[model samples]
Target: MAAFRDPLAGFVPDALVLVALDNALSRGWPDAAVSDLTRDILHASGIADGTVPAPAFAALLGDGRADLVARVRFLRMALGDLALGFDALTGDLPTFMDRAQTFGLFRYDKAMSDTAAARAEVRPWVDYVSALTRLEAAHLVPRLPGNAGPDWLEIGGNSGAFAAAICAARADVRITVSDLPAVCGLGQEMQKGQDRIRFQPRDARKSGWAAELGARDLLLFKSVLHDWPDHHARAFLTEAVACLEPGGRIVICERGPFAAGLADASFLSRLANAVFAPFYRDPSVYEGWLRAAGFAPTRQTVQLDMPFHVIEAVRA
Candidate 1:
């Protein structure tokens, strides 16, 4: 027999967590005494089983994670203060969505859907891709092992910025970023000054894609797999297995699966994420893919404002 719990009772601690988060914000994240207060918010126990994920919040203390924290801080400001305002709870969402749609969010996606002529100016994915290069890249490079060697390959790398960041960090490492022809052209122009980083036009969707890739010390799939269905992701990993040296590594950097559970005390943030938290995956799911692809995988979740899983698989 189990004791019955109050159905609406969970909101109590949720409310307290909200209070603490609000107080923390007033002092601000970069201000003195914030870290201690943050620790309290993270460790504070509550009745609700679904509190914010602790790892993402705890990650602010780690090295090189500041860039992501800054990005999160800016986003918090961009969303504006929720005080004395109508959240979706008060019927703002219906009207807000209607207005945001008018700004061409759907139109932008529609433009990109055209295979023969995807508009570059609209760049529906610019914010996401920019976060990769500007915010997450610095944090990503440090986690990759030194065995990444001189020859590194990034499959489906857009704009080649991740590879550029790696090359900038490691003078000895040369990298090649492979993507569609259109993206390659843009990447070539954007990455022009970087001597060690180059772009190659390759449609990863085509069969026998890796036959000409040559041997490489490391192959990376940075935030690329989640958009793919499981079968495609598994098939791509199988194809990638043959492209690496015996001791070479395959590093997959992806966002952890999104849960409706609030990661912050803010309901507004959760509401925004409900729109779509692009990185949808479980590290275990990738483990199965790695096993079938002929490598032993090890997983890590690093806090880059939001939690990101770095799965490393070493070739057998």
Candidate 2:
């Protein structure tokens, strides 16, 4: 009974309704079962505006609506982090929810759509250039000795998606993508037939096996640093620097400031902070950290399709 009633204590009815309406559970049920349940509860609660219920929910749950209760229970538990408002709950939902959505579920369709939307939305020239700054470290691939291939490490690689993509594109580079155990499991699964990509678990924060990430031509921080506070980020950079080969590079893709007077970027900034945590950085601060970590800054740019500043630096 406690297990069943647990989800009701902090129910956000509107978010449930929104989840129901936008059920793109490209994954299987009960994961995709939010919509039907939300519809029933919203219709019965008669909130009209689609806000979550307080009293109405109690009544609905008390009436032995087990299936409805179960469905709502699942969605409420899944989306508990959303803190959704009535308008957001009722508005047409985005098709995908990524790490930014604050929701536990990672709807594939929504993630792809959100990525596409993010790319289309980034517009300012300086902002785009800033994104490419972090990419510069990874871009060193082209500058490699041309014949002597370099093995690389992709720290905090979520599902090895980008790593696999990179491996597929570059035969000369062997990328070992590392993350937490569970994420590495997912990445391992995703990288199944790819010989150039290997998945491993290496926590970049505390002292662990991460120190073994040794002497590679490039250290890929793809889109990870901003998720941590300054101290942790600094430690990560120091560790990465130590692991690079002479003339080795560090490439980072992180949320950074946009050019002056860009309205769209303001929204993106807020969204990234809310999603990525610890807040994104000013370019100067990031560059400072890079320099202090014994890296020589090379390039910084914001890619047209991304909100991140791509930064490249060489280990000095």
Candidate 3:
């Protein structure tokens, strides 16, 4: 197996990155520690190779700014803490999911209960990430069955950002986002003026959700499926396959277990994985599900820097 690479390996802190880092740091760690750690990381990453000057570092890591101590701590944990039984912190998927539910972190069902406030609180960060990868996703469109004029259906597409990206790239494609009624309403509001994209209320766990959309040429599952256990994930694939037309394709993009070995992953990435470990599986698990759903794999792309995997399969 190839060694895992860090998603933020060569990342230079931009404004957004700094803000996010700051937010994470503010949760813990002192200002002095953060400043010292920021300087150390900057020097080590070669971003402050003596020529950058001390005032620049001061500006970036000033007292009121977000601290980098958490990042330093993550690096230490990734390297040395594993030897001290830190790996025990990561439990299997079921345990993690149970703990998350107990803490009210896994509340998709609640958000879907026709509550606008709950839906509003659920930020569509997954779709934002998808939008960032829009070009890469768009490149796969031509490989699908009806690329010239595909009828697309996205299951659990919150806020319709991914669908909007597809529609923006391919004018001939008509994309529909299927989610719960509350989520669909939020999506419709988010995509108010996009004619190529539409929103429909449907539960993904149930079969025949796609009956109203007729046969779709391409089915998309972005950052979904891993939320459920093996049985539910398989059922989702089965239902998705049933919704597809002859020669139609299914595309699943999600983060999986490939990041466990990423020694240099960002602190935020490590924290997220730790929190959601139970919801992720290996790529092979998804391949098995697709096979069981009666689809043959056409392409698979594993991101080198992150744990994200894009698996595309075709029906018959």
Q: Name the 10 consecutive residues with the lowest summed lDDT in model 1.
A: 1-10
By lDDT, the better pick of 1 and 3 is 1
TM-score for candidate 2: 0.55
TM-score of 3: 0.66
On the 0 to 100 scale, the lDDT of residue 44 in model 2 is 56
- State each model's CA lDDT, in order: 0.61, 0.51, 0.59
Clashing pairs in 3: 93-278
Model 3 worst lDDT window (10 residues) = 64-73
Q: Candidate 2, 142: how far from true, in Å? A: 9.7
Model 1 clash pairs are: none
**Candidate 1 residue-wise lDDT, 1-316, digit = tens:** 1222212123224434545444454554334345554546635643111333245443433453433333343334323322222353245645544444222332333332324355364243433364445656767778787766688889878778788888888899998898766666667776889898887777676667567777788889997887677778887787777778768889999877666234632443343343434337778889887887677898877665346788999865
- TM-scores vs. true structure, each candidate: 0.62, 0.55, 0.66
Angstrom error of the Cα, residue 87, model 3: value is 8.0
lDDT of 1 at 49: 19
Cα deviation of 266, candidate 1, in Å: 6.7
Clashes of each: 0, 29, 1
